[model samples]
Target: LVALPHANAQTDPLPSWNEGAAKKSITDFVARVTTQGGTDFVPVPERIATFDNDGTLWTEQPFYFQLAFAFDRVKATAPRHPEWKTTQPFKALLDNDMKGLAAAGEKGLLQIVAVTHAGMTTEEFARTVLDWTSTARHPRFHRPYTELVYQPMLELLTYLRANGFKTFVVSGGGVEFMRPWMEKVYGIPPEQVVGSSGVVKFQIGASGKPELMKLPKIEFVDDGSGKPVGINRFIGRRPIFAFGNSDGDLQMLQWTAAGEGARFAGLVHHTDAEREYAYDRSSKFGKLDKAWDEAVKRGWLVVDMKQDWKTVFPFEK
Candidate 1:
């Protein structure tokens, strides 16, 4: 990894990325789009790039951060409910027992998210996420979860932005869920994050602050078809590059690489089982079955996690 120049009017674009096939592809694409001499240059500077948040940027092993947040929320709130001590998943979470909750599966996780996430205002929820992310440490890694983010990916984000690429996190995870701390963690601003979101309505509080309420119903679940839809609605432009780790991102990658002119699409495979939990076609969190097949079929770069990545997380200790 190289020390990159800050984003400025004349920063030599995409300096953070390495000098390899990946770097060459990215550099060439940007050059084609911006350089006057390059053939088939896109006149407009609309290089939208989408990335999946979980498993792509950070370690998503034990489970997703949002899920862990929801579980913690249940633990914090379960005492107030009292009856939760007798409930199935709620009781499991209240006891700080994730294995029991796992026995209940994804439905159980959703229940935890709904009860803890649905009633609060979106702003409150966002603040809560920020608060939690700041303090919470990953269980196995024993580092702040934010610190567990892939260093190479961070480099790639900077590289893209340097090349005049507008990056968006098009994730299956919640939008209000991620936008809170992503700016600090990923250098991605809140507006650029497009993800699954609960319906948010503006409400004027007694303090006269305009607050956004988080409705129980989901306004969007930005996975599968929703990823493309979110991109169309939020970006209004087809992406030139897409990066993802799972089958959930197949459509997003497809849409970007299929577009006209030079495009880049790649998948990050989790192969380092010792450093991080390895799961691909068989695993639960970010399953890679369809994407693995499609990546090969489409000639998309399949990044072998251990080989392509020089480092996994940002924590030095």
Candidate 2:
């Protein structure tokens, strides 16, 4: 048997990150929190880092992955329910009409989610998510969606964990949807994830077995102001560091930065159109409008994707 190689001593913790102010700020903040007897030093147990999953941790371009999954489910379930052929949103989804889908709006999306995500037990949903995540690929990248996660962000998560900081994903995506694969992908376990979710009921099924059935009704919408509400409700502690990429995350950033002691907030600006899709202020999905102003005004680290990252995904590295 051959001996395994050890980690390179000269390897940078954030190898995908280029030498820049944004990278420096992250390293500096981590240093401050871990340094003993320093004014900015924080206890290991108190070092909670929350990250918005969509654009902040991975890609949310074109559409949210959950939406994509819902669309695929609509197609798969169409054979069972022929009435979907005549339905408004379902017809739009079947016809591949983006405009019609948009016109259907939140109501249409909720319908899709209800039909696709509900009725099944949480375990069933977990299995479905696991199978899909293993097979599903990003339309643009032509790689498994899990493989599309940003390398720099992955490095940051690893770096934080190494420094005894606990990392948690606070996304607007479905909590159950994220929980299945987050531990494998982000090194953050299921208990540490907080996200929007539908209601669940514990009941005996027709098979005479007890199960937690997912319901269509919304239990919570964890975005904007709701982010802080979720953080307080779930984590029970204000995060020392918050990372996000949209106006939806402004309140979370504000909440984290407003806390006493040295706080760090970062925004991942999608500026590299060549390596990744870029749209800000006017884009429908993951709009970075009001938050950009706040980042500048508050002197928060705004990471320029083009300038700050040497590589985008792990494949590039």
Task: Estimate the TM-score of every prediction.
Answer: 0.89, 0.96
Per-residue lDDT of model 1, residues 163-210, tens digit only: 677888999998888887789888999899999977777889778988
Badly placed stretches (over 4 Å) of model 2 are: 1-9
lDDT of each: 0.80, 0.92
Prediction RMSDs, each to the true structure: 3.8, 3.4
In Å, residue 219's CA in model 2 sits off its true spot by 0.4
lDDT of 1: 0.80
Model 1: per-residue Cα lDDT at residue 283: 83
